[model samples]
Target: MGVLGIFKKGLTKTRNFFSESFTKIAAGTGHFDDDMLDEFEETLVRADCGLPASSDIIDTVKASIRKTGNDSREAVMDVVRKRMLEILGDKTSFELEEGKLNILLMVGVNGTGKTTTAGKLAARYKKAGKKVIMAAADTFRAAAVEQLKSWGERTSTAVIAHPEGADPAAVVYDAVQAAKARKADLLIVDTAGRLHNKKNLMDELAKINRVINREAPDANIHSLLIIDATTGQNAVLQAQSFAEVAELDYIGITKLDGSAKGGVAIAVAYNSKLPIILAGLGESVEDLVDFDPIDFVNSLIE
Candidate 1:
C-alpha cells in the first residue's frame, strides 16, 4: 500500500474516534463558539492528546477564529491541522548518511516492541541497499538474543549476540567491531527493555553508548525510544523517563493500529520535543513507516 493508505489503515481506530467527535461538534452550531471549542478540546483530551496539548490546540483554534472572523467547521479544522503540524514539527524524515556507520540504539520498557522495531529497522536499512548489522544487546531477557537472531535471519542481516546473562554493553561492543570490520552502513542495537526507574539497566545503556562512542567515534549514533501507542498518556511518561537517562534522538511508536489514542503521538512529540521518526502501523516489517505529520493529522481529523 501507499504511504497515505498505510496511514489511513494504521490510524483507523484513532480516525474513527476523532471523526465522530468532530462531526458531532461541527454538526452542532456551525460556528466556532465557546461551546464548540470546549467540545473540541474535550475530544482532543479524550483522544489522548494530553491536557497541555489539548489546551494549546483549543487556544490556537480560538485565536484563528478570532483573527480571521471565520468559524466554519472546515476553516477551524484547517487551523487545527496547522497547529498539529507545528506540534509534530517538520523533522519527520530519518536519514542514514552514506559512508558513516549509523548506530540506532533501541530502548524502552518491556513489551513495547523494542526487539521487533530493531529488527524491522535493520530490514528497512538493508532493503535500502545498506549493509546492516543487528546487535542483540538485551541479554537480560531469556529469549531476547534468539528473537533478534530470528529477525536477523528473516532480513538476512547479521546479528551480534552473547549468551543470556552476559553484559549488554559487551554485546554492543562486539556489534560495533563487527560493523567496522564488515564496513556496514548501519548497526541497530536491541537493548533490554528495562523500566525507566531501573538505575542499573539505564546505567547499562549508558555503558553501551560509551562503548559505541569510544569504539566507533565516527559513527552517527541515535537513541530511539520505542513506545506503544495504546499506552496513551503513559507513552509520554515513558519518553520523559527515558529522556532523563538517554539522549533520545527520536521516538518510534508501535501498535498504532490497536488504539484510538494515536493522538498520543502528537502529545509525545509536543511534550518531549523529540521528532517521531517512525511508526509501526502493523506487524510486518514493511509496516514500519516514516512519520509524516501532514498525513498523520489528515488521517486523524479529516
Candidate 2:
C-alpha cells in the first residue's frame, strides 16, 4: 500500500476521537465565546492533551479568536490545528547517519513488541545492504532472548546473547565490540521488557548505556522507547516515565493496526517532546515505517 494509504488508517482513528469531542464542544451558531472556549478546553483535556499543554492550546485559540474576531467553527479549528503543530514542535526526522555502524537501543515495558520491532528493524537494514547484528540485552526474561534469536535466524543476521539472568550491560558491551570488529553496519540492542522494582530499571539501563559508550564512544547510539499504541493515555504515562529514566531519542509506537484510539501517539509526542521515529502497522517485517508528520496530519483530517 501507498504511504498515505497506510498512514490514513491510523490518522482516521485518531481524528475520529478528537473530532467527536470537538463537535460536542462546538456551538450551533455563535462567535468564539467563553462557553465555547471552556468546551474546547474540556475536549482537549479529555483527548489526553495534559493540563499544561491543554491550557496553552486553549489560551492560544482564545487569543487568535480575540485578535481576528473570527469565531466560526472552522476558524476555531484552524487555530487549534496551528496550535497543535506548534505544541508538537519541530517534527524530528530520524535517519541512521551514513557511517560504518549505527547502534540503537530499544527499550520499553513488556508486551510493547520491543523485541519484535527490533527484529523487524534489523531485517529492514540488512535488506538495505547493511550488516545488522542484534544484541539480546533483555536478560530478565528467558523468552525474550530466545525470541530475538529466532528473529536473527529468520533474517540471517547475527545475534549475540548471553545466558538468561546474565548482566544486561555486559551483553551490550560485548555486542558493541563484536560489531566493531566484524565491521557491522548496525548494532541493535534489545533490552528487557520489564520494569520491576524501580531501582532495577534505573540502574540496569544506566549501566547498559555506560558499557556501550565505553566500548564505542562515537558510535551513533540512539535509544528508542517502544510503546503500545493500544494503551491510549497510559502510553503517554509510560513515555514520560521512560524519558525520566532513559534519555530516549525517539519513539516506536506499535500495534496501530489494532488500536482504535491512536491519539496516544500525539499525546506521547506532545507531552514528552520525543519524536516518533517508526510505527508498526502489522505483523510483517515491512509493516514498520518511518514517521511522516504531514502524512500523519493528513491522515487525521482527511
Candidate 3:
C-alpha cells in the first residue's frame, strides 16, 4: 500500500469513529443543523481531540456557516479539514545529515514505546545504508538495556549498553566512542524515562547531552519525544512537560492503531508547536512511518 493507505490502515479505529459519528450527527437531514453542532463538537472531543481544540474547530465551522450561509455536510467538512491543517502546520519528515554523525535521543515516560522506537529507528537508518549503532542509556529501568540489545540483534546493529544502575551518561560516553571508532553514520540513544522526579530527570538528560557534545561535537542531534496516543489528553500534557525538560526537535506518536484517540495528534500539534515527524501506526518494526499531516487529516476525518 501507499503512504496514505498506510495511515488509513493505522488509523482505522479513529477514521471509523469519525465517519460513523458524523453520519449519525447528520441523521438523514443530509447536513448539520444548529442542534447537531453541539453533538458534532462532542464527537471530536470523544475522539480525544481535547476540549480547547474541539471548541476552536467547531467555532470555526460555525463561523463559516454564518458567513457563507451554507451548512451542507460537504461544506462543513471542507472547513473542518482546512482548520485541522492549520493546526498541524506543515508536515515534516525525519532527515539525516549526509556527512556528519546523526544522533536520535529518544525521550518519554516508560510504556510510551521509547525503546522500541529506538530500535525501529536504527532499523530504518540501517536500511538507508547508514551504519547505525544504538546506545541503551536508559540504565535506570530494569531490562531496558537487554530490550535494546534484542532490537540491535534483530536489526543487525551494534548496541552499547551498561548494567542496570550504571550511569546513563557513562553509557553514552562509551556509545559515542564506539560510534566514532566504527565510523557509524547514525547513533540512536534510548534514555531513561523518570518523570516522577523532574529535577533528577532533567539532570540526567543534561549529563547525557554534555557527553554527546563533548564526544561528538560535530554530530547532528535530534531529540524525539515519544508519546502514546491511547493516553488521550495526557499525551498533550507530556509534550508540554518534555518541551520544558529537553530540547525536543520532534514528536513521535505511538499506538495510534489501537486507540480511537487519534485526534490526540492534532491536539498535541496545536498545543505543543512541535512537528510530529514519526508515528507508530502498528506493532511491527516497519509500522513506524513519517507523520504526513495532509494524509493523516484525510484518513481521520474522511
Q: Mind giving the per-residue lDDT tens digits that candidate 3 earns over 247-271?
A: 9989999999899999999899889
With a 3 Å backbone cut-off (N, CA, C), the pairs that clash in candidate 3 are none
Query: Tens digits of per-residue lDDT for model 2 on 145-219?
Result: 999999999899899999999999989988998999998879999998566555788899999989988888888
- Give the per-residue lDDT of model 1 (tens digit) for 215-288: 99989898899999999999999999888878889999999989999999999998999999898987888888
Give stretches of model 3 more than 4 Å off: none
Clashes of each: 0, 0, 0
Model 2 misplaced regions, further than 4 Å = 23-27, 30-32
For candidate 2, list the clashing residue pairs, or say none.
Answer: none
**Highest lDDT scorer:** 3
lDDT of each: 0.90, 0.80, 0.91
Ranking by lDDT: 3, 1, 2
Q: Return whichever of 1 and 2 wins on lDDT.
A: 1
